[model samples]
Target: GEFGKVEEVKESLDLAYMIKETQNLFKGIVEGSSRSMQIVKDLRTFSRIDEIDGVIQFMCNPCGKLSE
Candidate 1:
């Protein structure tokens, strides 16, 4: 009976560790995807700079910073 109880405890601990690891992996994937999305958005804004009526636009905000 004592040995069975020890085995159960070990299994529970293993499951907890695996869950934590999975969470960390998903977090990284989400962060990477967000960065990629931002890059694409910035590229779109940059492309629009050349779309004016023969006038080059800075494509920036009032603070002189690139619009996010």
Candidate 2:
């Protein structure tokens, strides 16, 4: 009975959700800026360059299995 009372106590959780939400809000602010938009565009271009990265990795897996 006494131990069960401890289990019912409110537990404080870490601030990870607050940090994530604030980061998302800040990201929106940054992305909305003109300079950030240019950087975002550049990022998109760079990201697209790796659009085939997964394909290349997938190909390597089969090749490695075959070479075994």
Tens-place lDDT per residue, model 2, 15-67, is: 67778999999988876796878989998886666675665454557555644
Cα-based lDDT for every prediction: 0.79, 0.70
* Global lDDT of model 1: 0.79
- Shift in Å, residue 56, candidate 2: 53
Looking at model 2, the pairs that clash are: none
TM-scores of the models, in the order given: 0.54, 0.31
**Candidate number with greatest TM-score:** 1
TM-score quality measure for candidate 1: 0.54
Model 1: pairs clashing at backbone N, Cα or C within 3 Å: none
Per-candidate count of clashing residue pairs (backbone under 3 Å) = 0, 0
